[model samples]
Target: MKKIDWYFDFISPFSYLQGELLHTLPAEVEIRYKPVLFAGLLNHWDNKGPAEIAPKRTWTFEHCAWLACKHGIPMTMPPHHPFNPLPLLRLAIALGSSPEVVQRLFRWVWREGRVPTDEIYWQALLKEFDATPEMLDAPGVKQQLRANGEAAIAAGVFGVPTAVVDNRCFWGLDSTDMLIAWLRDDPFFSSEQLRQAQQLPQGVHRKT
Candidate 1:
């Protein structure tokens, strides 16, 4: 069976969006869910998240809403954007929850639009999953999250909702269709070497 390594962060709306389409993958393909921190990845790459910029944040909200509505999926932006996702990530990992649990977390944050800041909220959520705070507070949970982040960086993954099949990385929610095509062994846009070779030298930057 073919394997797909799916890297995602619970705080990313794009990740939530992509989760809706994960069922489309062929039954023969095995998916491995990897929970990584979006903030950590951004920091590693020296990149800015969509919520970090005012213009991008505004556009992201509107765009996400449109997409949810278009796809007939329930979606409501959480009270806060880009809030700390460590708790959820740790909780998921510590509980050894399946990918479906991750999807539920996304809905709690995105579709139900709830902020996980309160202890009461977390307790209630945990109870629903038959987990306790002690599980989330386990000593190894934090390290596990860190290890996941580091592993993602080492795997050429720069962002969430990424799909890696045999070392080929596909980033972003918009790349789902392309990823599906790739899983079926379809021809891609171009080989990496060909793409680099076709690039034109710009201005005086070339051998001037």
Candidate 2:
């Protein structure tokens, strides 16, 4: 079975939408979540920061709402964002190999809009996984997460919810359906062709 590498940022609205329904992988498919630093990409592209990008931000909110409606997951604009994706990203990298924990945290934050910075929130997020909050802020977690972010850049990912299947980069949440199909080798899901012809809002960075 091929593993789907999910490089995601909790701060990404699209990723929030994708994450909610993303777990329905077939028995042969496995998801590997890499909590990546979206801030670094924003800084690199010189794009409008997540908060300032009005169109992207608004689109993110609406897109999430639409996906929530479709998936039956309750989602709302987070109370706060432009969150330090650092800690969360580190948790992903530190536990980079653990899909169980990654899926748990992803659902907690996106489905519930829970920010990990709050100790209680972290506790609640990790409870299902039998993990604890203190391990997140352990010394060097932030720095290590930063290194992972650098690795994301090296991997040619410029945005959230990147799914890399065997070194191929699917750089958007919208592409997950294709990612899934590809992993399954479902003729109906031609990931390679979709990657070639992905119709995305290009040339415009999520408008602010």
Candidate 3:
């Protein structure tokens, strides 16, 4: 079976949207759900999230809503954007980071439109999982989360909802179709044009 490491953060609306579409991948593929902190990625890459910018933030939400409607997937923005995803990430690790747990968390945040900061909903979620905040805060759980973040950086991941297969990273919800094509042994991946594109020289760099 082909293994794909799907790195995502609960704070990313695109991640939630991607989660809903993972089932469209080839049956031979085995997905490894990796929960990473989106903020950690931004810090490491010296970048800002879309929500940190004004106009782009509005466009992002609007585009996501449009995508959901176009794809016929149920999605609703959480009460807030870019809320702390650490708790949700650790909670997923505490629950073994299984696909079921990951999908459940995504749906809770995106479909149900709730955040951990919502005390009542948070408590209900914990009760349903037969867990507690202490469990999510366990030393091992925290370490695993840290490890996931470190591994993500090491893998050259710069964003959430990235699917890494054979060390090649396909990023964003838009890349889903490309990933599916590549998984199905698309010849473009092995063509000479792709090799030439990889060898293309950089024209210029933005001033720091």
**Who wins the TM-score comparison?**
3
Clashes of each: 0, 3, 0
Cα lDDT tens digits for candidate 2, 72-133 = 87776656876665556666655643766666666667667778677777766567555555
Give the Å error, residue 147, model 1: 1.5
lDDT of each: 0.84, 0.69, 0.93
Task: Output the number of the lDDT-best candidate.
Answer: 3
TM-score of 1: 0.89
What ranking emerges by TM-score with the best candidate at the front? 3, 1, 2
lDDT of 1 by residue, 29-97 (tens): 998888898988899888999998999999988998898888887888787887888888887798664
List the candidates ranked by lDDT, beginning with the highest.
3, 1, 2
The candidate, 2 or 3, that scores higher on lDDT is: 3
> Please, what's the RMSD in Å of model 2?
4.8
List where candidate 1 sits over 4 angstroms from the true fold.
Answer: 189-208
**Model 3, span 12-88: residue lDDT tens:** 99998988899999998999999998899999999999999999999999999999999998997899887988889
